[model samples]
Target: MWGKSTAAVFLGMPLSVLVVGFAALLSHDQASTTLPWLLLFFLVWIAVMTCTFLFRTGLRAWLWMGGLTIAGYAALHFLKASGLVRIAA
Candidate 1:
């Protein structure tokens, strides 16, 4: 539980950001949409944390979360390079 809790606290935050980023990118990416994601971020973070505990072990949680974050960043870069979305970063 300690490992899982740590993973959830540490990894889950970035995963939630990536998820929100993905949503924002796929959406209209305007000021009007900002509030919705701001509201939804905590929900997504909580969901990711909850889902982490469903993994078989702490290592799995960390591995999967890390892998997912990497994949998410890759996808973000791909989208940016592909010129599909205009990312400030």
Candidate 2:
């Protein structure tokens, strides 16, 4: 119970953030399209939370989640820096 909650906080949240950030970046050109993207991200968050239980151990879950979140952020950063994706102000 506590472990699942911990995973939701430390893993699920960041994973959702990464997904939302990428979606936002991809849809930056069409700001009005954000609503659907946000909806999709919410579904993704639910899926991520459910999937966390598949790991055999809490530590493994945290490690993989943290690592993937970091990698996703890094990729987003690279894409933005390279101007492959433009963020609207």
Candidate with the greatest lDDT versus the true structure: 1
Error of 2 at 83 (Å): 1.4
Instruction: List, residue by residue over 1-89, the lDDT tens digit for candidate 2.
Output: 56666886778978997888777767646577776777788788888998888888887888888889889989988997888887675
In the range 1-89, model 1's lDDT, one tens digit per residue, is: 88799999999999999998888767765566766987899999999999999998899999999999999999899988999888443
Lowest-lDDT window of 10 residues in candidate 1? 25-34
For every model shown, what is its TM-score relative to the native structure? 0.88, 0.79
What are the Cα lDDT values of the candidates?
0.88, 0.81
List RMSD in Å for every model shown. 2.1, 2.2
lDDT score, residue 9, model 1? 94
